[model samples]
Target: MRTVADALHDRHRDQLKRSQLQAHPLLTGCAPWVIRRVAAVADEVLFPPGELLAEQGRTPGWFLLIRSGVAEVARNGALLGVVGAGDHYGEVPLLGRGAHPATVRAITPVHAWVIGAQRFVPLVDDVRPIRETLAASLAAQPALVAAARAELASRIQSMRREGSNTWPGIRPPRRRRSVRVLHVLAAIAMFVAVAVGAAAMYHPPYAVIRPGPVVDVANDIEISGAAVHPIHGRYLLVMVHTERPTLLSFATAAILGHHRPVEHVTALGGQPDVERQLHGQFTKSQQDAALAAAAALGIRPSASGALPFTVRFRDRDVVGPSGGLVYALAIEDMLSGADHAHGRTVAATGAIDPAGDVIPVGFVDDKAIAAQRAGAQVLVSPTSEVYLAADSGVRVVGASSLREALDRLAASN
Candidate 1:
C-alpha cells in the first residue's frame, strides 16, 4: 500500500544521504564514485544519551560518521576524547582487530550515518585514499592510539583472570588418569602447528608491491674522475619494495587492505632469475645514463668505452632500471653546472635509453607515496605513468625525454 508521496519522500531522503556523504571532510579526497558506493550502503541511526554505540571487547559491526550531537571515546573508563559532527571512529576494528579497542558512548543524543562492517571493510580494502585518510585520522589522535594498544593487554589480563578462577572447587585430576587425554591433546597441538607452518611457507599466486625508501641523489651519488658541480636542491630516486606473499600475508592484506597485490607473473615478468635480470638492467641503466648525460653536454665518449666520468650509487638491496631518469638528471645537472632543481625537492622515476628517451615504469603511484613521505615537492614521471600518481597529493610532472624533464624542473618554482 505505498503511495506516490511515500516514494518521492524516500528518493529525497536517499539524495540527502548522498549529499551528506559527499560533504564529509575525511572523504573529501575520495573519488565521487567511491563516495556514491559508500552512500548507497550507509544507514541513518540515532543513539540516546549514555548508550554504548560500540562496546570494547566486542566485534565491530558498524562504522559511524557523525552528522550531529556528540559521543565520548573511552577505554576502560579513561576518556580518550569527544567526537561531534564531522568526526569519526570505529576504524580500529576494520583494521583486523578481533575486538573493539575503545567504547563509544553517546554524550548527547547522537545522530550518524553508519555502514555495517560487511560493507565498510570492503570499501576500505578497495579504496586507497579512504584507507589513507582513516589512518591519518587515527594517527592524529595519540591518546586513542595508546588506548588501542592497552586494550590488548587488558583483554589478556581479563582472560587470565576468568580462566584462573573457573576451577576453584574442582580438584586436580590424577596423572595416570590424564595421561591419555594429555597425549591426545599434544598430538592435536602438534598437527595444528605443522599445518600452520606449512600454510605460512606456501606462496600465493599474488605478489605485493609497497613503497620503499627514497634516496636523495645529490648526497648519495658518488662522481669519480669528473668535475662534480654543486647544486642548490635535491633530486630523489624513488624505489618500491616487492614481496612474494605467503598464505598468511596474502590473507592479512585481503582482510586489512593497506597493501596492493598483483599477479606473480605480472610482477616478475615471468623471469626465472629475477634478481640477476634486475641487477643487469640496473647496471645497463647506469651506463646508458652516463652516455646520455655526456651526449647532452656535447662531450664525446673516451676511446676506452664510455665517458671518463663514473657514477656510483650507494649500495642498496633495491634492484631495478626505474632509477635511470633520476640518475641521468643528476649527472647532467652536476656536469652542466646548472641548478635545474633550484630550491625545490624533486623526485623522479623512469627508465632511460642511450638517446635520452624516458621509458614508462610500473608502480608510479607507490613511488609517489614514497616521494611524498620523503617531503618531495615535485615528482617527474614518464608521460604514460604520470596519471597514475595524479591523486598522490604531490605535484607531478610528465616528460617524454630527458631534455623535457630538465626543462620542466628548471622552469618549475
Candidate 2:
C-alpha cells in the first residue's frame, strides 16, 4: 500500500530512532519516536581537543549525544569509562536533582548534539508505552514497589480529604530537581527576616556620638540637704549608639566620622562588662560633678555630710564617661544658681576623674558637628583638637577641668 520512497523514508526514521535509543541503556524501552523527536530539537556543537564537556556533582542543564571522536568520563577524580560516537552522557540532573556520577571531557576533537533538560522531559512524557515499561522495571524491585504503593495510597487519601477524587495537574520530570523553588524562596525570605531582626536587636561593634538631652543635674544632686538653684543653660549629654560594625559598617561609620573600635570595648573582657564599666564611669562622674559644682558654688560637700543624690537619666542610653564636664556644670548651676550659661545653649564632652579633671574622649568631631547643627553657642572639649561643623558655625572651647568649663561657660555668656 506504500510507494518505495515512502517506505524507505519510514524505514530510515525507524532505523535512526532505534539506533539512537538503543545506544544508551536508560532509553532502552523508550519508543523510537521519542528518540526521533529528541534528535529533532537538539543543537549541534563542536568541541576542540582537551575540552571539558561537563563536570561531576554539578546540576546538568543539558544532555550531550556524541556523534564523533572520543570523550573520557571520570568519577570522584578517578577514571571511569570512555564514550565514543553514538554515546550519550548526562542523566542524573535530568532524572532528578542529583549530582552527575562523572565528569565528561573531550579526548579528541568532538562533535555532539546537546538537548536542554527542559526540552527533554516532555519527550519522555509523550512516550506512554516506554514510561509504563520503565515503571514495570521499577515495580520489579519490592522496596520501590512498596514505597510507590504507599505513596499512591497516601496521595489518594489526601485528595479525598480535600473533597477531590481526581488528581490535580502535576508537573513532571517526576525526576525533577531535588530542591523545589518554593523551598528556596522560603529560605531566602527567612534569612532576610533574621538579618533585619538581628540588626534591630543586636548591639553594634561601633559607637556613635550625637547630642543628647540637657537634663537638670540638680534633680540628681543637692547641697546641704537643700535643692540647688536651676542652671540656666541645660548641661549637654553626648549620647552614643553602638553599631554592629564589620569592615563595611566600620568604613561607613568612619566616613561619617563616628566609629570607635571594639578593641577598647573588648579590653574589659566583653560587651556586657564594657557596658558595666561605662555605667560605673558615669556614676563616678555624677559624684565628681556634685563635688565640683559645690566647690564652684562655695557650697561645701563636707557641710552637707555625705552629700549624695540620685541621678536619673530620662534616656536609658547613657553609655560612656564623655558627659562628665556637662554633668558637673549642670550640678554647679543647680547648686549655686550662677546662671553661667545666661540662657545660651551649651554642650560638652570629656571623661572626668574624682578631682573633676576633664579627660579627652573619642569621636570629638562627631559631637562638635552635632552640637553645631543644634545651634549650640559653645561646644567644649578637653583637648585642642577641634572638629568644625559643616558650616563651621559652632565655637570650639577647650576645658581642662570642671572649673575651666564653668569659667569658659560664664565668660562666653
Candidate 3:
C-alpha cells in the first residue's frame, strides 16, 4: 500500500486538475503545466440555498467564480444585482485591495470554484487580458456606466452655469417697464422653481435605497380545523385549532417578513409530532409528552363560541424564511401607524429577535419558492441569510434590522 503522504498528494493532485478545467478564459488558455500550478492553490465550495457566500465590506479570502446557480448581490438592504453561472464575482476587492463593495448571497443551490488570493494574484499579473476584460465589463454595465456619465455631465453643466463669463454676442433683454409684466415674470419663475423642486423630490432616479421598517396588518382570519391520528402510527397528526386566525396570521406574516410569501399555507391538514416518530412509535408516555409540549406552546382545543378566522396579511408568492424580517417589520409598522399594506403582496422569512434583528432560520429556498407560488412580489430578508433567497425569480431586499424592512415597504408604497 502507498504511504499516507503519497495518498494525500495524489488526492490533492486530482483536486488541482479539476480546478484547472473550471478556471476562467485567460486561465483556461494557459499551458497544462501552468493550469496545474494554479489549481494546486485553488479551493472548491458548494453552498445550499440560504447559505451565506460572502458578506459586504469584508476582504474576501477567495476569488470566487460561480460554476452553477444564481447569487444575489446587495448592500445595506438594497439589491445590487445577480451573479449567475460562469460569472466571476468577488474579485473587485481582491484586485483593488479595498473593502468588499457588496454582500453575495446564494439565490439557488450553488457550486463554486475558489482560488486563494495568494495564488490568484500572481496569476493575474501574467494574465493581462483577464484584467482588461474584467475592467471593460465593469465599465460597460448600464447601471454603473450610466450613473458615472450622468454625474460627469451634471458637474460639467454646473461649472458652465456657475462660470462668471458673459455671453459673447448676446445681451440680456432690457428690464420690462410695466409692473404687471414684472409681477407675471416673478410668478412664472416661482412656479417653475416649485415644479422643479417637486420633480426632483418625487422623481428621484430608481437607485437602490436602504430599507426601512416593515409593518403589516391583519387583513382577514381563517381557522385551522381538526385532525385525526391513527392509533398505531409512529407520529401523531395534531391539527392546530385556533379561535383567532390572527395568531397563525401573525406567524405567517412573520414568515413572510423574511422570505417570499406562499400563495396560501400548504394546508398541511395538521401538525405532525416529529419527536414521536424518532422514538419509533408513540406509546402512552410519548403521547402524553407530546400533548404537554403542545400545550406549553399554546396549542390546545378551542373553547366553545370561539370563531374560526384566517387573516391574509401579504403574500410574497414565494416560499422560504428569507423574508422574516420584512414580514415582522410590516406588522410592527402597521401597528405603529407608520405604514399600511398598499395591497401589494409582501413575503419574507427569518426569526425575529426581541430587539428586532432578523436571525437566520431554516428552509430559505423552499420558503422563497412557496412565496413566489403565492404571488408575493417584494421579498425582505435578513442580510445574513439572503443567500437562501436564490433562483425563485422574485425581487429580494436585505434588511439589517426590522425597522429597515418596514421602511422599505413604506417607501415602496
Candidate 4:
C-alpha cells in the first residue's frame, strides 16, 4: 500500500483507458481525467451494419457515443440525416424531459459506448467541456432529430386527414340521411359506455401523489445471501401515479397533493410510448441502485450479489427516473453493514445518475407537502430547493449527491 510503484501503475492503467476514449471525436476535447472517469463506468457495445439501435417515439434509455462507423437517423420511412463517427443522438431525449423523436440504425460495423440514463445527467450536466461539446455536435446535426420529429408529426396528421380508419360494417352516413336524430339518440349511450369503461378499466390522467411508507431496508428486504447490508433506518420515498380520477379522487388528492404525466396517451403517441418510459425509468432505478450501493460499500457492483445480480420493480406506473435517488439509497442500505439511516424517518427526492449526482426534479413544493404529511422527520432533497420544505414544518436538508444525503442522515443519527 505504501509503494511508489503501485501509484505509478494505477496512473498508467487509467491513462491507457483514457487513450481508448481519445479515438472518438466527441470525446477528443475531453481532458484525459474526464475520459478516464467516463471510461471507468462506460460499457462498450458493438452493432453490425443494418442493426436497429433505437426506435422512434420510444423513451430514451441510453446516451450513445459513436466510437467508430456510421449510423442513419430516420422517421416514418424518410431519411433525416446520417450520424457518423463522433456524431451521436439520444441526449436530447435522455435529459430533455421527453421521449425520443426518431429511429436510429447503424449503417456500418460500429462500436459505441452506452451510457445508461442514470449516468447521463450526473456525468455531463455540470461538465462544461463535455456538455458544450455535445451541444455543438447536436447543433450541427439539427435535421437528424428535428426533421425526423417533423416527419412523424406530419405522418400522424396525414393519418388523421386520410380517414382510412373504416370500422368494420360501419360506414359514413349519406348527406340526405339527416343524422341529427341518430346523433342525439346515440349521445347518451356513447357517454355511458365511455364513462363506465374508463371508470372500471382505464386509469385517468390525474396523478395520485403522496408520501408512502418509510421502510427500513435491512428489515424490509429478504436477502438470502450474506451481504454486508451497510445502510439503515427508515426511508420515506414518495409515490406518484397517474390514474383515472373520479369525483372522490380529486378530493382525496386535494388532501394528498396532485400531479400528472406531461406526455399522455394522445400527446405521446399512445400506450407503447408510456410503457417505454416506464421500462427505462424502472430499469435504470434498479441498475443505479446496485451501482450506488457498491460505491458506498467500496466493492464492485457485481460483487454485491452473492449469486447473480438481479432486481425487479413491480410498480406499473413508475413512469420516470424521479425515484432514482431513493432506489440507490435503498440498495446501498441493503448491501452495506453500516446503519446510514440510523433508524430515523428519512425521505429524499432527486434523479440519481449512475455516478450518484442528484439532479433536481419538478414539483418540489407539492412533494414537500406530501413528505410532511407522510410523517417524515427528515427530508433530503436537491441542494437548490432543500429550503423549499423548511416552511413545511419538517427538517429539510440539501444534498447534491447520494453520498451527501446519506451522510446528512447518518450524521444526524
Model 4 C-alpha RMSD to native: 15.1
Q: What would the per-residue lDDT of candidate 2 be over residues 1-413, giving only the tens digit for each residue?
A: 78999999979866654564454445555566766776566776877545678776555678777755456666566665566555666543454434454677764346676878787667557767644644555445444244334444555576688866446676455564688899999999999888776666655544332443443343444345566566565555654343444445555566776544333232233335434545666676666766665566565555545544443443344655666777777766765677887887777777665567665555566677667666778877874335333344678888767788878877877
TM-score of every prediction relative to native: 0.49, 0.43, 0.33, 0.48
Q: lDDT per model, in order?
A: 0.77, 0.60, 0.49, 0.63
Best by lDDT: 1
Superposition-based RMSD of candidate 3 using all C-alpha atoms, in angstroms = 21.8
Task: Write one digit per residue (lDDT tens) for candidate 1, span 43-108.
Answer: 878775457889987767999988654566666766665666567777866564546777887643
lDDT of 4 at 40: 68
C-alpha lDDT of candidate 1 relative to the true structure: 0.77
* Candidate 3 weakest ten by summed lDDT: 233-242
For 11-35, candidate 4 gives per-residue lDDT tens digits of 8866655665775667776777788
Looking at candidate 1, the ten consecutive residues that score lowest on lDDT are: 265-274
lDDT of 2 at 156: 56
Per-residue CA lDDT of model 3 for 1-413, tens digit only, reads 89999999989768645653434543566566666665666676777644677776455577776655456666665766566555777556665555456677664455677788787787677656556766676556545444334444555576798775766878888886666888999999999888765654452211111122222323311113333121110110111111213233434444566322221211121212222221221132222322322332234534752323221323322222233343344333333344334566676654443345444444455556655655667666655457767687766667655656656666877
Give, for candidate 4, the lowest lDDT window spanning 10 residues. Answer: 260-269
Clashing pairs in 1: none
